[model samples]
Target: MRDFRDAKAMAQTLRDALKAKSISVSHSESLELVAKTLGFHDWNVLSAAIQSSQPAAAKSPPALSFNGGTVIPVAPMRDIVFFPQLISPMFVGREKTRRAVESAAANDGRIVVITQRRAEDDDPDFDALYSVGVVADIMNRVELPNGNQKVRVSCGKRVAVVRPAEADFLAAEVVPLEEVRALDTQAFALTSEIFEAYRSSTNTVPPQSLYRYAGEPGVLADVVVQLLEIGVEKMQQALEIRDVVARLETILGWMRAGAPAKAS
Candidate 1:
């Protein structure tokens, strides 16, 4: 049994193990991998906890908001919001959410994930969930020994929930959201600044693949959204804006000035 007392050591061990398996991951990727392995949402969450010398319980889960086009099947999240462009590991204990995951996996793996406005609301109705959420494709599912199912979902785009969570699990009528991004010099510059803000705000290591999506306003917006510990309200505000530039500006302003960890 190997015990990890330090984050850097665990990262090196992870990097080495991956290397031994003939897998190559960049430093940032490795850090994020280790962070994920440690049960934190992302590298920033893990790094912050380690630096603060607090228990992992003291560490907050960084929630992201994801929304995209029309979709069926809804997965309600607890505590934190979810963002697109990231693969999330969700432990499903609720029967409805479990059924939703099973149903989505059986049917092309497409579903909408929405955060419950009240964290304690295990069974949320239409009004109990937020209006905006991310639509994603379920990539894989793993059944745990304790009966909880872990599902890996790849977020695609932002969306507005047209329908609500109902019946068994949650099924909603959702519409995919499209950002009106101006593909001009000003837009490009704002996108670049947004990326820089993301790079500056993140701790431990930033993701390497984020560069691939940097030029894409929607993807970049999502990538940045996931990395920050921004509140759910501001994130929802950012999600409602149809303009990519405006969303980026709102998020960037959050980055520069910072906000309370939890949404008010």
Candidate 2:
């Protein structure tokens, strides 16, 4: 059976076949026909609604629980969204963010990272940032000669920043967004499609490590997002999504649409 991609390709083929038959059908009309055949209002609508109807992240992650634990330090990432399994090199110059790093390092090296809603907001308050982010372990830090701090961290898991816990350094109460292991048939299929989409993308050069993460749906979704180098908005959407299947679909859909059609 043809999946969404395959079916779309068939739609294009139908358009070509119609022209070959000397039948008159405009390209846009053909697309509308294709959309109807696929049960959508039009191609534009199908593009957005082609995804699985269910919300994946709404299902709780297996084997993990959110323990706000102690309020880990909070670092506001400007124009960047971090995901688990990805290493991030961040430069800190802001006083609040630097202090947040130092405080987190003094403890268990855990910190909540949330993205500012606007990159230009130098002094971002809680209302200026996105609530969803990742909890990461600050693995290494060095004081640069330029009066800035260079930090390397590995993102752990998705988290929802509940609110600020008043403190001198930036600190936030966060709830861990638990994730489930991908062992189901649907997940396996989604993983396979994401791999294909990544391979097909013209703008992306997937890392060699892609194969290592492909079997695990969650990691695969993250890997594709990291490798594709898409916009921050798209990356944020992918990161906030919890359903391994839905996450994979979003990444795959973006990649598929990003590339131009191959020559026959």
Candidate 3:
């Protein structure tokens, strides 16, 4: 077993590093991994330490930029942590959403798809929303019988939402996030354990499907994280973690704690 004190210290150091860059760590699983890795046996101690060492406020949201005179807001049906390599066809049923899709296809063929923060609320005027979302390009489209539409979109890049715009349809100004180079050590032992557990639980192997989408070893963790039916807050934490090894360990801890069962 790992020493609880050491683990807490390591987690605190990493937490400080993340805070310096305006990134917020929301997932409990990630915090647990940080504790375990540093040799802590109890996660509660680490959590208390983190709460005590909380950093200053996060920086202000950035401004949005437009392309081809069109900007749109979108809500994702599922949490997409890392964009799948293959193009995914989506069905847009809402009036505002369909209009946003159509406008994107008509203008620059691009739209931002952010995970729906409020799944239960039916109201359309919700103000608090996740700022980070992906900007996807339209690949194809078709009309449905019920006045709805189907669209095929390919993930382009990650973006930060500035603010919601008042328009005939839902629109938002966005700026793209910087891409980070993959690090080798992210393929840690915890990743293998999680993969094995996932296979045993589902009676299905993910290597083949993951390879088809992303070939690199470092990208495997991201692909697996995206496939899991976890919450938006957890997915956002995985995206915010810069260290690949730390992210994989965080996911593995969640798996061990029976996250999938709870999610289902």
Candidate 4:
């Protein structure tokens, strides 16, 4: 039987080969191969070493939140947040979501975007949702070639969903989050530098609508937030900060430090 160390070395060689080719391999796959080569009956021996190292995919689907009242059945969708410096466009498909979009368009075109909590079991009666999200305003609407409706939305502000309300469409009673404290000038300066670097690297240009809707601070903050792949929790935390300068600094710090190493 092959020695365990020999098996490990073989697995490392495979990993190195894959990396050189720009092809990715999961740690689990390598562990399984090593176990089989080493004549091990079980693969769990490498459990501690072979945690999943894959990156998470894009944002979740959109979900609805009620502001004025509560609903018995909650409709869930994956939510994508638009940071102060970013802009996002979304498609509306479901009847409820389409209705929500129409209502927001009629009522100043504002909506809160938040992530949906996965159902605990097969049952869909779960009502729990993430509390943090961004408030966005519809900037433009267009009809796609396939007859789907595409809406361009720009980040308006950060908001926390205080309570869920019942509505025919997505609705939420959200109060704007306080700005981040500006006490960390060092953080702010560092973040700004990172933001500039990201923009240069990505070659992203702000939309004209952003110029119309965003104030000076909003423009800078939105740009940075748009670049980072932040999740519901981080987005919420950023929004909860009441100080504008501090919020920018927090986002900048995240950009510099990079995202969490683990996949979501």
- Candidate 4 lDDT by residue in tens digits, 80-170: 4446534767776567767777777777667666555552322222145555556677889888898668888776555555445567765
User: Which digits, one per residue and each the tens of the lDDT, describe model 1 over residues 39-153?
Assistant: 6545544553453344546544323222322237888888767776667887788998888888888877888888888889877886787777788889888899999988888
lDDT of 3 by residue, 1-264 (tens): 534435545566667787799876754555677756754432543433333233324323323344322356564444344352437777778777777787787877878776656656443542534556667878998898987678888886566554456677767765555433344444545556766867765666755665452435446666677667677789877655545666677777776676662212
**Which candidate leads the pack in TM-score?**
2
* Residue 94 lDDT (model 1): 91
Better of 1 and 2 by lDDT: 2
Q: Clashing residue pairs in candidate 3, if any?
A: 2-39, 3-39, 3-40, 4-40, 7-38
What C-alpha root-mean-square deviation, in Å, does candidate 2 show against the real structure?
Answer: 12.5
Q: What are the clash counts of all predictions, listed in order?
A: 15, 1, 5, 28
lDDT of 1 at 131: 71
Residues 1-264, candidate 2, lDDT per residue (tens digit)? Answer: 775445467777888898799987776677668877876534544543342222446434423333423567888888888888778788899999998999989878888888888899998887787767888889999899999999999988887664568887678766556555456678888877776665576435545567787668788778667666676787787877766777777777777788342211
TM-score of 1: 0.64
Ranking by TM-score: 2, 1, 3, 4
Candidate 1, poorest ten consecutive residues by summed lDDT: 62-71
lDDT of candidate 1 vs native?
Answer: 0.68
TM-score of each: 0.64, 0.70, 0.61, 0.50
What is the lDDT ranking, best to worst?
A: 2, 1, 3, 4
